[model samples]
Target: MNAQSPKTVDDTRLDSVIYQDGIMRISYTLTKTSKDEIDSDAFTKDKKALAASVSCDEKGLGQFVKSGLLIKYTINDSSSAPITDFQIGKSDCL
Candidate 1:
């Protein structure tokens, strides 16, 4: 008999509508194979970098840069609370 390891997959979801501040937030739930959790400072830094890389020019109205980002990760299946939640953005995004 042969045994195979289970594949790990992470799911990410985005809200249908973007916030008024021109920020789009995405959420991801942690799984058993995922890391314990990340600190606020690290989370903030990473999310900001991610937001900067994303393009917000959906309407073709010039090049719109990503001003901010918010990321939240939930730990464990029992708890509804998030393990880490972070948001970063620019003041003059619009």
Candidate 2:
């Protein structure tokens, strides 16, 4: 899936993609800021919208969601330290 990895998508840079335990894990590094720069409260508040975007997607992500694939997004800081992560599953969408 990560044919062109380590690429920048907006402000985040996709580092790698892995699959294990029926989950597609995508790791991204925020190129613009550090973990401390991100507001935790705002990130938490946007969880639902993020999950919905994945759930309601029609292109290809939704297909993965429907097929019971747990999609995980792991964001790291510019220093390569993990900031926060979340998973979008079928149950999360519902």
Off by over 4 Å in 2: none
lDDT for predicted candidate 2 compared with the true structure: 0.78
* Span of 10 residues, lowest total lDDT, candidate 1: 71-80
| Tens-place lDDT digits, model 1, residues 12-65 | 322222345555444444443233455646864675555544433445311433
Give per-model TM-scores. 0.37, 0.80
- RMSD vs true structure, all candidates: 9.7, 2.1
| lDDT of the candidates, in the order given | 0.40, 0.78
Residue pairs whose backbone atoms clash in candidate 1: 68-89
Hey, what RMSD does candidate 1 come out at?
Answer: 9.7
Which candidate gets the maximum TM-score versus the true structure? 2
